[model samples]
Target: MNPFLKPFACHWTMLDNVRVKKAGDIRLKATRSAVIYCTPCGRKLISQAQIDNYLHETKSKLTIELFVFDCKANMKQHYCPDGKILDADISNGQENVPISVVNEVDKEPNK
Candidate 1:
């Protein structure tokens, strides 16, 4: 069995206050609230469609990796796009910050 599928207490990033609008629209339309990340692996599973696709592709029966907190272990079980798992440290380090702030920072160009 893949160890990544095992359940663990996960530090989750809750998605809230998400909105979308046309280029000049004054009102921001609210989007559904969701839990976006497991934090430790930096992987996001935002919607049912996405979750279904992942399960279909991986043929995985477990959904625990989508929500569990111990993503470090999960991270070790997967490969990167380059066909390898990242060897460097993996940490979001913003576990205490609001998701809105994190989203803004993610939008900025890396210095």
Candidate 2:
């Protein structure tokens, strides 16, 4: 009988709601994920916002850097800190472009 409380209740109970949201799928497009890789170590750190949040909360601001030895081999797969493999734009993550033009290069020839 309560109208205002209905939406919140729906959000709380339904596992289906979390399954897939827009675009007929739940996984986000690749552009949404961050490009994270560790250098001189095998740990790849994706999710820029999460990383920034960690740095912010911890108050330990040390500049973290990554060197792309081989973009393909390094970025073959990505995972969140929690160990969930991210599916954001994996298609374009592996590419070799001029140092200045990495993101702008055309990686989509399959279309």
Candidate 3:
């Protein structure tokens, strides 16, 4: 599995946008966009014109990311020109997950 995609988990919400899940004192905010590479291809820079073209052609929201596997091998595939949007949810387990920076006040006192 891709290291970037490993932290993500499927989270369905009634809201029109993505959501973040948290456990205990930890909180994860759903960023509007996050840079990520395609599973089939590597990170490639895209132009504004290309992104606009894709959005117009697909008739999809600008918040969505594009995957271009149909392009030729020589062609570069850039998913997010504006920035990669996070569509998946972050896991909320208390196991061996790496801890992100958090305020000390947010943590509970030791038992």
Q: In terms of lDDT, which candidate is strongest?
A: 1
Q: In TM-score terms, which candidate is top?
A: 1
Which lDDT tens digits does candidate 1 get at residues 31-56? Answer: 43332433334445555566567557
Clashes of 2: 2
Candidate 2, clashing residue pairs? 30-88, 30-89
Candidate 1 versus truth, CA RMSD in Å, comes to: 18.2
**Which candidate order results from sorting by lDDT in descending order?**
1, 2, 3
Model 3 residue 31 CA deviation (Å) reads 24
Q: Write the per-residue lDDT of candidate 3 for residues 1-111, one digit (tens) a residue.
A: 322222122221111122223222223345422222221122222333544464467564432333322222222233433333232223445536743332334344333
- In order, candidate lDDTs are 0.41, 0.34, 0.30
Q: What is the clash tally of candidate 1?
A: 1
Q: Please, what is the TM-score per model?
A: 0.27, 0.21, 0.19
Q: Which of the two, 2 or 3, has more lDDT?
A: 2
